[model samples]
Target: MSLYQFGKNLVLVLFKPIYRMEVHGRENFPKSGSVLLCSNHIDNLDPPIVGACTPRMVHFMAKEELFTIPVLGKILLKVGAFPVKRGLSDREALRKGLKVLKDGEVLGLFPEGTRSKDGQLGKGLAGAGFFALRSDALIVPCAVVGPYKPFKKVRIYFGKPLDASEYRERKVTADEMTIVIMEQIRELLEKHR
Candidate 1:
């Protein structure tokens, strides 16, 4: 098995018992093609928690700073993560994201760009919206609900996939597309939480 899968499996084994983790709508995931697993961030563990529950191997856009770290950088790359410069228009990062989708891979993104201190979804950056508007990838809205308290139930609800074709035909702006994505994420959170 791939290291990503092994790592995901290992995490599920450990987390399920401790966190009582439950995943909903995992079957909503497409079996093939490029897809963007978009979600809201509440905690530092959101990425891994969502990734571990995901059936497909998800490539994340981690901050460029993390890639500067010693061995952690290599490990992140080996696990299918790429770097993104936060708070600036990094065209290189955008190109990389577009290329990943064009290559028919799963790209995971937390559109808020960072963890929410209040567990409330924030405004998604143009970067994420740009990716959605530019790619033909399926936009799968997901929500991570509940706390990380030990033995507490932590649920990840993967909502329906928002096909970008219609949105693309309308030629919507990146910010508009991100708003739609966030709306879906909010719906999932409301329904599941």
Candidate 2:
């Protein structure tokens, strides 16, 4: 099996049942081509939990600091993660992200840019909107509803793809897309929370 598959399966076995994960709306996932999963961030486990539940491998642009941690860094690469320097206009990371979509792969992003301390869906960074505008990939709004207590039911909701093509064609500002993306995520949270 591929490293991404192995890691995803491991998380399914280790994180899914342990957290009592309940996934909904997975039928919205695309069978092929590029997809960008914009989700809310609550805990460090959010990425793996969301990734494991999906039918496709999710390549997340993780914070650069994590990649400096020796073994963990290697493991991330094996599982198809790349590093991003947070709070900076890291063009290299953007390039890698766009490339991931161009290659017909799935890329996961947390629009808020950081984990929410109170588990609330926060405002999306404009950078996320920029990335979405740059690609022809499907933009799917997803939410990880959680208090994350052990054996507690942690719900995950995947919504249908937003009309990214409209935004792209109109040449709307990055802020515009950011607002729409966050709104979709917020709606999912309100429904599931």
Candidate 3:
């Protein structure tokens, strides 16, 4: 197995027992083609947790600051994560994300832009919509509800893919698409709640 897969499996083994993770709707995941795993961010553990649950290898867009750390940076690089600046529009990060989709890989990112401290759904950033439109990727809305503490029975629900074909040819603005994306994530969160 590749280093990324190996690491993911290792994490799953350790995390499943601790969190009592229960995954739902994994059948909605597309077996192949470009896909955007748009999820609601609740905790720092969300990325790895999502990665471990999905069968496909997920390339995540981590905060740029995480890439500046010494040993952690190298580990993140090896684990299929790229750096993304949090606040402003980072063209470089977007370009990398687009490249992943264009190459027919799964790209996972939080639509909320940052982790929600209160575990409430937040407005999604335009980045998810922009990438979906640009790459014509199918967006799989995922909801992760958890306190993220040991033995808490954290739940991950993967909703149906939001096909971008309808918006691909249209002149849809990023902000408009962001609203749609956010709505889908909200629906998924509600379903699981």
Candidate 1 has what TM-score?
0.96
By lDDT, rank the candidates, best first. Answer: 3, 2, 1
Model 2, range 1-193, lDDT digits (tens) per residue?
9888888888888877788889999999898999989999999998888998888989999999999999999999889899999998899999999999999999999989999988877788987788789988888889998889999989999999876899998989999989989999999999889
**Model 2, CA-based lDDT:** 0.90
Highest TM-score model number? 2
| lDDT tens digits by residue: candidate 3, 1-193 | 8889888889889999999999999999999999999999999899989998997999999999998999999999998899998999899999999999999999999988889989999988999889888886899989998989989899999989998878776879888887888888899888778
Which portions of model 1 show Cα errors greater than 4 Å? none
TM-score of 3: 0.97
Selected candidate, larger lDDT, 1 vs 2? 2
How do the residues 70-100 of candidate 1 rate in per-residue lDDT, one tens digit apiece? 9989988999999988999888878888999
RMSD of 1: 1.0
Which structure among the candidates has the greatest lDDT? 3
Alpha-carbon deviation at 55 in model 2, angstroms = 0.7
